[model samples]
Target: MANKKSTKTPAKAKKSDKKPGLIARGKAYMASVRSEMKRVVWPTKNELVNYTVAVCASLIVVGVSIAVLDLVISEGLVLFASLRG
Candidate 1:
Protein backbone atom coordinates (compact mmCIF):
# COMPACT_ATOMS: atom_id res chain seq x y z
CA MET A 1 0.00 0.00 0.00
CA ALA A 2 1.32 3.51 -1.00
CA ASN A 3 1.00 6.44 1.43
CA LYS A 4 -0.79 9.46 -0.06
CA LYS A 5 0.02 13.10 0.82
CA SER A 6 -2.78 15.34 2.13
CA THR A 7 -3.86 17.98 -0.48
CA LYS A 8 -5.73 20.36 1.88
CA THR A 9 -3.98 23.60 2.95
CA PRO A 10 -4.28 24.90 6.52
CA ALA A 11 -7.11 27.37 7.30
CA LYS A 12 -4.48 29.80 8.59
CA ALA A 13 -2.47 29.58 5.32
CA LYS A 14 -5.51 30.60 3.22
CA LYS A 15 -6.28 33.59 5.46
CA SER A 16 -2.60 34.59 5.69
CA ASP A 17 -2.39 34.86 1.88
CA LYS A 18 -4.87 37.82 1.86
CA LYS A 19 -3.70 40.74 4.01
CA PRO A 20 -6.09 43.11 5.79
CA GLY A 21 -6.71 46.53 4.10
CA LEU A 22 -4.74 49.59 5.24
CA ILE A 23 -7.65 51.07 7.22
CA ALA A 24 -8.48 47.67 8.73
CA ARG A 25 -4.84 47.02 9.68
CA GLY A 26 -4.57 50.49 11.23
CA LYS A 27 -7.77 49.95 13.23
CA ALA A 28 -6.51 46.57 14.42
CA TYR A 29 -3.12 48.09 15.44
CA MET A 30 -4.86 50.88 17.36
CA ALA A 31 -7.14 48.35 19.09
CA SER A 32 -4.11 46.30 20.18
CA VAL A 33 -2.39 49.48 21.44
CA ARG A 34 -5.48 50.41 23.46
CA SER A 35 -5.63 46.92 24.93
CA GLU A 36 -1.95 47.07 25.91
CA MET A 37 -2.28 50.58 27.35
CA LYS A 38 -5.14 49.40 29.56
CA ARG A 39 -2.76 46.82 31.14
CA VAL A 40 0.11 49.30 31.71
CA VAL A 41 1.20 50.31 35.25
CA TRP A 42 1.30 54.11 35.21
CA PRO A 43 3.78 56.01 37.39
CA THR A 44 2.49 58.36 40.12
CA LYS A 45 2.96 62.16 39.89
CA ASN A 46 5.90 62.13 42.32
CA GLU A 47 7.47 59.24 40.46
CA LEU A 48 7.09 61.10 37.16
CA VAL A 49 8.74 64.19 38.62
CA ASN A 50 11.61 62.13 39.99
CA TYR A 51 12.04 60.42 36.61
CA THR A 52 12.13 63.79 34.83
CA VAL A 53 14.73 65.16 37.22
CA ALA A 54 16.88 62.03 36.89
CA VAL A 55 16.71 62.24 33.08
CA CYS A 56 17.61 65.94 33.04
CA ALA A 57 20.52 65.40 35.43
CA SER A 58 21.80 62.53 33.32
CA LEU A 59 21.60 64.64 30.17
CA ILE A 60 23.51 67.50 31.81
CA VAL A 61 26.25 65.18 33.07
CA VAL A 62 26.61 63.50 29.64
CA GLY A 63 26.72 66.86 27.85
CA VAL A 64 29.39 68.22 30.22
CA SER A 65 31.49 65.03 29.86
CA ILE A 66 31.40 65.24 26.05
CA ALA A 67 32.33 68.93 26.12
CA VAL A 68 35.31 68.26 28.42
CA LEU A 69 36.50 65.39 26.25
CA ASP A 70 36.23 67.55 23.11
CA LEU A 71 38.18 70.42 24.71
CA VAL A 72 40.97 68.14 25.96
CA ILE A 73 41.38 66.37 22.58
CA SER A 74 41.34 69.67 20.65
CA GLU A 75 43.96 71.23 22.96
CA GLY A 76 46.17 68.13 22.74
CA LEU A 77 46.01 68.24 18.92
CA VAL A 78 46.92 71.94 18.91
CA LEU A 79 49.87 71.33 21.27
CA PHE A 80 51.13 68.43 19.12
CA ALA A 81 50.89 70.54 15.93
CA SER A 82 52.76 73.44 17.58
CA LEU A 83 55.55 71.12 18.79
CA ARG A 84 55.99 69.70 15.24
CA GLY A 85 56.26 73.21 13.64
Candidate 2:
Protein backbone atom coordinates (compact mmCIF):
# COMPACT_ATOMS: atom_id res chain seq x y z
CA MET A 1 0.00 0.00 0.00
CA ALA A 2 1.29 3.47 -1.02
CA ASN A 3 0.68 6.57 1.22
CA LYS A 4 -0.71 9.67 -0.52
CA LYS A 5 0.10 13.27 0.64
CA SER A 6 -2.70 15.87 0.94
CA THR A 7 -2.10 19.28 -0.76
CA LYS A 8 -3.91 22.43 0.59
CA THR A 9 -4.92 25.38 -1.61
CA PRO A 10 -3.78 28.94 -0.80
CA ALA A 11 -6.19 31.46 0.77
CA LYS A 12 -7.75 34.22 -1.41
CA ALA A 13 -6.89 37.92 -0.90
CA LYS A 14 -9.49 40.46 0.30
CA LYS A 15 -11.20 42.70 -2.30
CA SER A 16 -11.91 45.80 -0.23
CA ASP A 17 -8.96 48.20 -0.86
CA LYS A 18 -10.64 51.57 -0.24
CA LYS A 19 -9.40 53.86 2.57
CA PRO A 20 -11.02 56.90 4.22
CA GLY A 21 -9.88 60.44 3.31
CA LEU A 22 -7.40 62.33 5.59
CA ILE A 23 -9.75 65.14 6.56
CA ALA A 24 -12.59 62.79 7.56
CA ARG A 25 -10.23 60.60 9.64
CA GLY A 26 -8.68 63.64 11.32
CA LYS A 27 -12.09 65.05 12.30
CA ALA A 28 -13.13 61.70 13.77
CA TYR A 29 -9.88 61.40 15.79
CA MET A 30 -10.22 64.95 17.12
CA ALA A 31 -13.79 64.30 18.19
CA SER A 32 -12.70 61.22 20.16
CA VAL A 33 -9.85 63.21 21.79
CA ARG A 34 -12.19 65.98 22.83
CA SER A 35 -14.60 63.47 24.35
CA GLU A 36 -11.73 61.93 26.35
CA MET A 37 -10.61 65.37 27.50
CA LYS A 38 -14.09 66.05 28.87
CA ARG A 39 -13.75 62.99 31.11
CA VAL A 40 -10.64 64.36 32.89
CA VAL A 41 -10.92 65.91 36.37
CA TRP A 42 -9.46 69.42 36.16
CA PRO A 43 -8.10 71.31 39.13
CA THR A 44 -9.88 74.34 40.57
CA LYS A 45 -8.61 77.87 39.84
CA ASN A 46 -7.63 78.45 43.49
CA GLU A 47 -5.76 75.13 43.64
CA LEU A 48 -3.97 75.91 40.40
CA VAL A 49 -2.90 79.34 41.59
CA ASN A 50 -1.70 77.98 44.96
CA TYR A 51 0.29 75.21 43.27
CA THR A 52 1.94 77.68 40.90
CA VAL A 53 2.92 79.97 43.78
CA ALA A 54 4.35 77.06 45.74
CA VAL A 55 6.41 75.92 42.71
CA CYS A 56 7.77 79.44 42.14
CA ALA A 57 8.70 79.84 45.82
CA SER A 58 10.46 76.47 45.86
CA LEU A 59 12.36 77.33 42.67
CA ILE A 60 13.52 80.66 44.08
CA VAL A 61 14.70 79.04 47.31
CA VAL A 62 16.62 76.34 45.38
CA GLY A 63 18.18 78.94 43.05
CA VAL A 64 19.36 81.07 45.96
CA SER A 65 20.80 78.05 47.80
CA ILE A 66 22.69 76.90 44.70
CA ALA A 67 24.08 80.40 44.10
CA VAL A 68 25.35 80.70 47.67
CA LEU A 69 26.93 77.24 47.52
CA ASP A 70 28.65 78.06 44.21
CA LEU A 71 30.00 81.34 45.54
CA VAL A 72 31.36 79.67 48.69
CA ILE A 73 33.08 76.89 46.72
CA SER A 74 34.56 79.35 44.21
CA GLU A 75 35.89 81.61 46.98
CA GLY A 76 37.40 78.62 48.78
CA LEU A 77 39.10 77.39 45.58
CA VAL A 78 40.49 80.87 44.87
CA LEU A 79 41.86 81.17 48.43
CA PHE A 80 43.54 77.76 48.13
CA ALA A 81 44.97 78.57 44.70
CA SER A 82 46.43 81.88 45.99
CA LEU A 83 48.04 80.12 48.96
CA ARG A 84 49.60 77.55 46.63
CA GLY A 85 51.03 80.27 44.29
Candidate topping lDDT = 1
Error of 1 at 84 (Å): 11
What digit string (tens of lDDT, one per residue) describes model 2 on residues 2-81?
98766877787785776778998999999999999999999999999999999999999999999999999998999988
Per-residue lDDT over 1-85 for candidate 1, one digit per residue giving the tens place of the 0 to 100 score = 6999889885664455688899999999999999999999999999999999999999999999999999999989989889645
lDDT at residue 30 of model 1 (Cα atoms): 99
Residue 45, candidate 1: Cα error in Å is: 0.7
TM-score of predicted structure 2: 0.72
List TM-score per model, in order. 0.67, 0.72
Overall local distance difference test of candidate 2? 0.92
By TM-score, the best candidate is 2
